[model samples]
Target: MKIVTWNINGIRTFRGGIKKALDSLDADIICLQETKVTRDLLDERTAIVDGYNSYFSFSRGRSGYSGVATYCKDSATPFAAEEGLTGLLTNHEGPVRCYGDHTEYSTEELQLLDNEGRAVITQHRIMCQDQVKTVTVINVYCPRADPEKPERKQFKLQFYKLLQGRAEAILKDGSYVIVLGDINTSHRTIDHCDPSDIDDFEENPGRKWLNCFLHSDKQEEESTDEEYNEAYKLTSTHDGKFVDTFRHFHPTRTNAFTCWSTLTGARQTNYGTRIDYIFADCQLAEEQFVAADIMPEVEGSDHCPVWGQLSCSLLPSSKNPPLCTRFLPEFAGKQQKLSRFLVKMDQKSIQSEQRNELPGSQEEEERRENLNPSGAGKKRVLTAESIIPKGKKTKTAKAASKPQGSLLTFFKPKITNVLPSTEAPERQKNLDQDEVTSPQNPSVKGSVTKDATLVLDGSEQLCTSSYPKDNDQGTKVKTPHLTSQPTVGPSDTKKGASSGFWKSLFHGPPPPPPCKVHGEPCVLRTVKKEGPNMGRQFFVCARPQGHASNPEARCNFFAWVDKGK
Candidate 1:
């Protein structure tokens, strides 16, 4: 039997179809990391393959972030499968099984560690030397530590600790373990491209944890008691022994990288670190494994697939695997199709016949005939008497006959009765006398005064603003009608002169910039990394991302928006 592991980056972004890609691998068991699909987004195509059973672990806190899945062929179907490293999920379809001691960590901490959907464990029975042994495969996508976020570094370390604890617990149960996926850390100086640039290459925290976790070949290198004790505090599996299958086979292989940086075209020069691995139990690697290697030539994802072949065949599988995808409700008979919700041809005809045989059919026709008395085809002129019963008197008609007025009457424009200019002088003199003789009233202390409207010719003008002469009395002016010529306002020639220049400056959005190599318009992108240049815009080649050797691939044309401006 053969087992393969790959970080596909995004399962939904596969070219052609997902099944075609899986067939090309030709392995009994395939594990994918960074699936980036939530439970609600899973479709039948990805979930149900022809002869394989699938198990998925989806991220609960985010959609399209971190996820993992495992597909097992019918010949290698597992009897049990469970999601998450915390062993807190109870909804799995298998017998209850616990990994590691849960009393070591609080319930809240365990939930936080498993919320990212990073791990899935499957137990399969395999025959080794005529003895049936249980082999547990743990597929994991470890979190990368962000330098800017201090909390993420802690989270990354906590995940590694929980993973180590569970693997050790499984080992104690007499089951062979195989932990595989993108570990995200280079183990030694030879594994990285430029070891000279990094100070103390093996002194990194993640590397230190890995060194103590794996079983060493030489006894002379086991004197580092202080480092072992530190790793023991973080991961309880410091005593558990496992072998790195790749390095065990090829101890001195160089330029054997499984991942690269597409942003800098690092794959063209083979400049990358060996981070992806398939670690197996020491006894299993020594006894049953035939060959273990990396397939760097495969090119669907930035990280290629790494596989391991076992010498012995799998034990007889059960008739029905407990956690198989075929048993899930999505692939099972529980889900219905669109045709099930629609009415069938026979049902539609039956409903029509039932309507024709109704008892009230004749009475309904007679009622329609009485309503349209003129003719069935003639148009009827609907009147108020027809709409309302003939003997009934509406409240609106009764109110109209009386002198009751409506609210709309108060909003109607009023006609002004213009006073002659001859009487205007006498009216102003009387108002001035009233203001001087009237005593100040305390009730009008805070009242606001407004200017009166004056009529000049046919148009109206407002009087100049002035303070009230007294608190109780206001300065009044009489509006008198005066015969005069129509007066004109200021001209708008200056406003029209500037409109043309403004329209030409902002006609529409500018055309996209063309790339130098392809002579095609470039695509716009924004910086997602957090820093001073975060949220900055840039333009690059429009073609899809591909290797440098591909003739139809994108060119390395990049320009920042600030430089273009």
Candidate 2:
């Protein structure tokens, strides 16, 4: 199967281009980024790609902004909105209620306050026809460059961390995973058209974003400055993980970039760096890895599509093949033609060999003797004894070149370390030496700073009362003074506030209590006693009186939860 990933820039304006890509490329699965249209705004009629099931994960944007969509061919269903990395549901708490102040702010500010919701990364599990194999595909579009504003850069880094966590979890299943989309960070210098132009100073907003992603843990001890610099050279500052796929398919050719600027018009020259990528597990690399750009003539998005094909086998006892893959339209016809040609060539070769060995009549032998008078007259003497040359004994060059030993043996290319340039000393002098520690408030770690201290008081009533109220004119008011107070302990503060203010402030709402009907000691187990779904243990009412038939049930509650082993 072949899968293609492309950032359609804006689906609305480029719907025709997208259609053309789908028609000409014939991707079995197409992962699109920056769709820029919400579910409600999408024109389904035009969005439809014939012979493929479509799924879209649009960002919560109105006009031009981030969004992603995927198209899958075959029985494999596109992830529903609730499934897949892009669709994970994030429950964002409403803005913290600030108490004791009334300040003027605009309706836009009020809307900003309302935008404090969390996002959940959706995960989709695609099961191929053969149930034995499955693969998970994620589409992401990280935040872009905006130096004047640093928050967008920070958001991009944070988004990558979240995406990494999600990816690690999905990989735990041991299934072939393919993550495609505009990751936003260029992993190396080769990934960018102009790497020298990238500013590495602290004031350079993009540099901070790059540093955040490349050094997520801030572990200065783990990586040398040179190592980090080399990583940067291999990755684009615009999108940091360019070398990630290279590491997966090591010893292979390295330059496989997808995104290029049309303004440059350098497509024919191949001068552009690779931005988009298709990353897969090493196990699936051989049978399922391929990447190439869609033609620039395809007037679609600024970015072209890159695709990969996967192949796997199944045994008689196996219910399904051991792999599930997405396909590309560009490869389908070519693959079929190649397979047909191979079979025909094999048959023709076999027929020719058989005809050569057929018994000849006396007339035919005489005709052959006339054609080769010297051979017929002499007792077909052997002029020379053929001997297998040392390396030529093997049919292919690769086989001849390989030394006999374990198949795992491989030639490691010698790597030379290049010294840093003379400008490095000046660049080091300009770098910031101070490290920014996490704020005293843990809540602020993953939240916006302006409202970080809002819910210090643990009392639910005080928390609710603190929220700015709407005045008689129906305009919402802000309480700037309330946020001005220095940090104070719960004991030193006013009465009726809970002592665990820090905990209460960040915890948001409480989760539902465990079901009493299931009782205290319910054991979970995986068993295949009943049927295909039987092994999965679901929470059941442990209380005898809580049984469904019992009218006097002590607790009529039972909630199912996965106690992952």
Candidate 3:
């Protein structure tokens, strides 16, 4: 299968240009970076490509800032998700400063990693010779090594360590992995055109970190003479490495640039850096290793596209479930008790795998081991997550469990009553506001339907119903696409955002994007969940939950938006 990575500096600029490349660069999957496209900017004309399904992760912190997208063939069996890597834990890893953060600003890097939409991973299941296998395709836009913003360099370094660790985990699942993106670092002098630009300081440090991560000399896990295999996990920054696909194919090729400066017109002189890459797993066939071509010929972006193809496939599919992966720190010196736990968990997973669920953890057992290690032999527990098997649920990560800036379970639906029911007419007036509840969800469609009625005795409230066509039973309704009806896009959108916010909520555009940007109580959003919380309205973070950009994040400014008053 063929795979490609390209950093389309401004996706909007490619209004007419994207179609050209999409047709020419036909591959099984295409990973894009620096899309600069907001959630609201996408329309049928640009977003949806025939015969292919699209997945996007937009920058919630700011409009059109940094985002990533992927387009895969609909024929391929995929887990069907658009996921971002968040909540990189600092428990086992020593010295947070090394990853470029202090206790005061601990959440800085993680927020960027999650909400900024720099990286996205998709798991696809395919069939090879009637055997099914799973493979992870990770597309990342690493933070640049910026000297002016020294902290950014630290952020970049931290990103490298976390990404390297993540790659290790994905591979442990017995899945073939392909990591493609704009790495933004010239791994060696040969990768770049100018030798003087390749200094040992600043950007060069990234090369050192990358080198250590990919080719560690340490013997991480050694099998012993015991009855069972000595399984192990490496949590340290320097673990093992990825096979850089480009270098693997053309080891001696020079001046194979992928990005150049638009200001200096460096592409004209062939003066550019080979920062973008597609790194395949070492297990992949050397013969299947095809050329990593630098397509400088592709126009519409400062960075050119990099393409590569592999012969074999990891054919596997998933029974899509909410995944929680807890990374285990380096567990050395103490292994006997944990080893027993591993054996038990493995056996339990066999039965659980049949159910398409993971083996639930024994929280009590884990608590005991963590509290008193001296009792390790008496009641043992594993510190980190083990390998994720095929067709089974992905691991639930501990750091990621409550990574929501102390706002755990932020996105889980809740019913809120911020106001009282008495002030009906006016509260009804704000409730009658058009276009806010515009997100394309089943509930939204139900709300605007003619049959949808409000229980306004301090219960569910009223809203506008923009029905274009009525049902035959007069109960039936027409589903109007967001675009055919004037597009109500982002607050400060990249393009195509004429109307602000959703039309079902507020009448005009949102005062700010999602929730109000800074200070004070932001606009209220409604949530409908099943169970007791069913038919209830809850208020949540407007800037998108779980991925706060900063520690001072979260309005923590909690209050209910009552159906009345």
- Candidate with top TM-score is 1
Runs of candidate 1 with Cα error greater than 4 angstroms are: 92-98, 219-240, 335-527, 535-564
By lDDT, who's the top model here?
A: 1
Give the clashing residue pairs of candidate 1, or none: none
Ten-residue stretch with the least lDDT total in model 2: 369-378
Ranking by TM-score: 1, 3, 2
For each candidate in turn, the TM-score is 0.61, 0.41, 0.49
Query: Pairing residues by index, what is the TM-score of model 3?
Result: 0.49
The list of candidate 3 runs beyond 4 A from truth reads 87-108, 128-130, 201-203, 215-239, 285-288, 313-565
Which prediction has more favorable TM-score, 1 or 2?
1
Tens digit per residue, CA lDDT, model 3, 293-375: 77889877889999997765633233321221111121112345555445443444344333432122221111111111111
Candidate that beats the other on TM-score, 1 or 3, i.e. the better one? 1
Question: What clash count goes with each model?
Answer: 0, 46, 42
lDDT over C-alpha atoms for residue 219 of model 1? 37
lDDT by residue (tens digit), candidate 2, 1-565: 5667777777667544556666676756677777666544666454455555555544331234455666655443433222223222222222111111213433343222212111212223443445556566666665554444455555555455555555545556565556677765665444555556557533343444444333222232134245455544544344332223433433223344466555334353344556566666544554445443334455455666766655542122111111111222232233444443233223444444434332232112112111111111111122222245646645556655743442211211111111133433344345421111133432211111222233333322332222444444656543222222244223454443544565566653233345564435432324444456665654433333322344433245544445432
lDDT score of residue 330 within candidate 2:
33
